[model samples]
Target: MHDPIFSKSFTRTQRHRFGAIFLCFIIALAISKPPLHLLSPIGDAVKTQLSINNVGNMLLVDDGGRANIKPIADVNPAEYLQLPSDDAQNKRTSTTISAYSDNGIKMEKKHAIICKNSNYCKIEGDVRIDAKSSTILVATSFANMTKSWCVIEPYPRRGTSRVKKWRVATLEKNDISLPICTQHHTHPSLLFSMGGFTGNYFHDFADILFPLHLTSSQIQKKVQFLATDYKQWWINKFDKILNKLTKHNILDIDRETSQVHCYNELQIGLKFHKELLTLNSSPSMHTFKVLLREAYSLKRERVIRDINVPMPRLMIIDRKRTRVLTNEHQVLRIARKLGFEVVEGVATDLSRFAEAVNSCDVLVGVHGAGLTNMVFLPDNAVVIQVIPFGGVDGFARLDFGNPAKGMNLRYLEYKIRENESSLSRKYSRDHPILRKPELYRNWDQVWSIYLNQQNVSVDLRRFKGILVEALTLLYYK
Candidate 1:
């Protein structure tokens, strides 16, 4: 009764001391050993703090107080993160190797497969590139042969097998023959050849980038590229498209022939169906056109047919040497008379040229590699292929006509008459090179005369009708 204040202060001090001792005990208990029964509660508390929810089956409580938990056999760990209702997510589940630890948590392992067909060879999963030997090493327990190897030329065209070849081998775990990995990449690798007909504008897209887009679009830009027969100019030329295709830097396998680069997943070679066309595929020509527009940051998706302007912009692909438009000025005059703003698609940097091509509503060109720029044209645009006079409609149609429809463009064939061809001026009408040119079925024969040495002077009256038709297609259909 004499010192009530002193008694209250003493009680507060004892409570503070007891709180500190309890906190220390909790910390020491966590450091020493975790009890199986307490693990779920501890994990739940942490999850709650992190605002994590619906992580089903990842945290199993040991209700029986047993130290061991049964492993989830052959079940992919990524599946647990998604809800059962997410079907699309399940289908796009990333390739992963799954294992189980003593605590029943999923661990990762090496899994690989080398799938080969007549068209291409696709190697995926835990892969290593030994540049010293120009070989690709895959790690997997599924290698039944103890050691197995196959040589693959990772290009789309089989005609370029001599350009480059890569040795792919499947090695068992703990194989002493494995090369030391100098670098590790978190993302998957896409390996292909830049050798086969890459310099040509047609082959650049038809053979390499088109097939590459078909193959890599499924990965959602999570892959890096490894190119054999690599060219810096080619890389720079398609930098914009490459940027849309991948976020990682491109590695030149030929130049860096000393490092051993390893990746969790690697895909050797691209998937190619046919040249310049995608048939019954997931990424159809329309989808590819959308990708191209997005990659170039093109402003137009369709040809502008505004009531205020009422005139469409036209692009004439002017070739310098072969298949030159001899009377280009008259063609320009006719196009202008019909209310078309004309511009020439000439040789320039690719990025700049792509923009110029996309801005136009109609693309006019002779059947040549320059017409390949139609890949950059807007949807519903018109492509007028002026076929040189050589009885080569089938060849010209195969090259540009059929693919134009696939890209959602209106294709028009303007077959130049004999009088319009420079070959007509050089030779007589009854000459076999002109009159009976159908006899030359071989491409080598056709290439030397009609393709290699030809120029066109369009019949003004007939060509004007083609332009009129192009205008009708733009506005009406």
Candidate 2:
């Protein structure tokens, strides 16, 4: 309405005032509104702001909303975090977190969730935890709020009527629940599954019995036994002795089955040999000797009668596989020369074999399965283990010396010299096979080449001293 310059100025002033009001309103709105973290997805919000550089010692937020957490010595800002929401609308299908125990056993939890407010972590879906030996624990739900205790609910078996009567028994009825809950402070019951027969005498027969010797008295009453080979006749015979020793019922389990829950497990090896030797006062040794006597119907008087004789009856184990005595005739000639009644043959009958071994004063054999027959020997008997080349310190001790000590047999090792080994003929002087037996990349190859395929040529001059030692031990004992 006024002059053109004045009108333009008024219009510009009005526009500037409106723009300033709008800018003020936008700034006010932004300042009053809640944070983006409250409105957006939790994982996305956390990923944007959270940085975890020391995941090994701190809680690691996983994509599935589960947190891999360790025990916190002192609470720090970084150690605590808000967990994702549990609203049905915001929930995802699954999540996982990896955890480790103080003993370094690794465990993985799947479909896990953590509550921020309560600090409780829950594991959902099927979870299997393996303890030592063949024992396993299966649970459907597990929760841990603190590092002190973990709560596990056993996975319910289908078609089971009673909650407490879940564990199925073969013959006897027990009202134990599946994944039976025991207090964290109380000692849980132990269950041992018979490791299947490895066929080797030392592995199958003698080694399996070692666990009975290794178990402590505190847990012995709570220990349960399970055997997979219930149908094998030899296993039945072996079970008799095991039952007598353990004084617990041995349950039969299906061959294909796996997974059991126990507080502890027994493994098969000579690692506990020293502990086993302390069981001389245990009834197991006496039961074992009695069972052997009953199995062959041998009179104790007869065994005693044989032991009292002056010359020791020496049975040189004839090998059918590896480490055969190449100079058996000369070796036998030498053995006979040493006043030993040498009994040598591939024993076809086990009873007769047991009887022969039981009657012997000294059992001589190259390190092999035949050496396991030393279990049948009487007390004060001598076991002359021929340490084939590459077997002096390793298999020789594990296979014989340790077990011989447990059986109360005097163990004598006859270490074969380099010249006695047949590998010298097949390999050159500078070859690794001849010089460095340990350098072989595969132990099985070394065993096959140096032990399984090779035979021994006893240097009679050198071996005589070992025989003399055996005689001295037998005579002195």
How well does each candidate superpose onto the true structure, as a TM-score? 0.74, 0.53
lDDT of 2 by residue, 1-477 (tens): 123443344444343344334433433343233221110011111112222222111111111111111111211211222223323212331123233333334445432322111111222333222322222333322233111112211111111111111121111012133433232212223233233222224434443455443443334445444343233544543554455445555555333234333322321111122212333455454445655566565543122333467656788877644677788788778878888887754565566677777778788777665676776788778888777775235545655676676576788888887789887888898987778765652433444465556678888987788888878776664
- The window of 10 residues in a row where model 1 has the poorest summed lDDT is 38-47
TM-score of 2: 0.53
Please give, for residues 196-298, the per-residue lDDT of candidate 1 as tens digits: 5555566577778887888788786898989887877678778888888888889898777778898877777776655577655568778888888988888
Clash counts per candidate, in order, are 0, 1
Count: clashes, candidate 2: 1
Predicted candidate 1, C-alpha RMSD:
23.8
Whole-model Cα lDDT per candidate? 0.66, 0.45
Best by TM-score, which number?
1
